[model samples]
Target: MNSKVINEIKIKDGRVLTLVEGDITERNVDVIVNPANSYLQHGGGVASTIVRKEGNIIQEESDKIGFVQVGSSTITSSGILPCKSIIHTVGPRMGEGNENEKLSKAINSCLGLCLRKGFESISIPAISSGIFGFPNDKCAKILVNETISFLKNLEDSSAGIKLVEFCILGKDTLQAFQYEFEKSKPEF
Candidate 1:
């Protein structure tokens, strides 16, 4: 983690959390990361949205990566998605994950790729809380915490990212990450 150059730290800067309720599939960000399965193949929910929008090339590119694991990820071009790139991050499966640790890593993987891709801005929907059924609060906590943890200490602080927005679809979720991210380090 770089930790020096600030890209999108909400608490550190003067900005409050940007929680928007809208369709993530159509948002125009540098990259719209997907909460994908290890197979990288699209199935349902957000996964299906990426596949349906990006065309068949997404699955074709994903096939080259083989099966990824929880907390890890892979990337493929968005064949038809509105964004320039599609980062496929495999979030932890419901109950099968290591509670907090693995989820943290998963969040990092997504953020790390954003930097690696030279993208300073990105958008992510709720990961693992839909069909994966991991519970919304826990998912938001892991995502916000791990994202803050990584961005705060990133060595590649020059990732050029100015914003990392979470385009949440519902109010309950918007409140969750906004709350956790507002907490002090040991407040949890």
Candidate 2:
């Protein structure tokens, strides 16, 4: 559990970046996550964004991996995305009692992989909170808290991850992170 709180979460000059939902194609980040099917195929939704930015290789290489279990993950090069990599993480679909656990894994995989790969910065989206149906506010609370806890546990080398952005796709999602972040702000 990373309890490290470097600073308050803000918009500009902040470590995290939140954008409008559904506009992934326009926002920029070091490495964007592709909410993919277990089969690693790129279809509609986030899949389409990856293809539009990283080229079809997003699907091709992913195909080689051939289906990840729900709540597990894999990685591939960004190819054409502004970022250096594309982490393929499978999120849970609409259901009760499954979203949080699955989201935890999805998030952990992305951060762990980036750290293992020696990346110092990364960007992510709320997992399982979109078309699959996890509520944005709930997912944001868990994701931010968990991610913060995870990062705080790392060494400086391990802690080199100074950036963990959330390119929000809508007002609700953006507000979720913002609201949660404020609650976690350090008391001066």
Candidate 3:
């Protein structure tokens, strides 16, 4: 559960974007996004880890909500986790048509949901980059770029999202995100 910050950048609006190497389930942010399947099943991967650590109430809530569409997101109470809420976002699987666009939409959906709920901080993983077969570097680029775009477009300086973190567990995934973070630093 120990997590460490790998990189961080501050945007003009005073918001912070960070790359962390650790378990997203341990993040104490306002919300932590779960890369989910449409059926809301927490069977394997990060979804399973979150449910195992945070308790089954997360799964129970997801069951009540039923299916969520790809490129969309839904929220549930955080259960025993420190975060206030969990945003389950369905990302596209590789070989799916327009995978890049779908991934972008998924990221945007999570960010938009966070804005609506007034969440000041959120932790997200590299959606679809695991068993779903998304390439790590591409996933990293899309996730980082989409998040920066979302924050920059917000008209209100007090939009409540002061922090956006990419919390990755694997070393390769963390490296990919770190590369993106470095590439995007100057632009921010």
Candidate 3, superposed: residue stretches over 4 Å from native: none
Residue-level lDDT for 131 in candidate 2: 74
Off by over 4 Å in 2: 1-28, 157-159
Alpha carbon lDDT of each predicted model: 0.71, 0.69, 0.93
Q: Native-vs-model 2 lDDT?
A: 0.69
lDDT score at residue 148, model 3, on the 0-100 scale = 87
lDDT of 1 by residue, 1-188 (tens): 11121122463332222444566767777788888888887888888877886678888888888899888877788877678888888877777847567677777888888887888667888888777877788887777766665655655444356676677766676667666655623311
Q: Evaluate residue 71 in candidate 1 and report its C-alpha lDDT on the 0 to 100 scale.
A: 85
**Per-residue error at 92 for model 1, in Å?**
1.3
lDDT of 2 by residue, 20-111 (tens): 34444444555677777777778767777769766677778887888798877788887866677888888888674577888888888878
Model 3: how far residue 149 lies from native, Å: 0.8
Candidate 1 structure lDDT: 0.71
Q: Model 3 Cα displacement at 37 (Å)?
A: 0.2
How far residue 144's Cα lies from its native spot in candidate 3, in Å, is 0.3
Q: In model 3, what lDDT does residue 82 have? A: 88
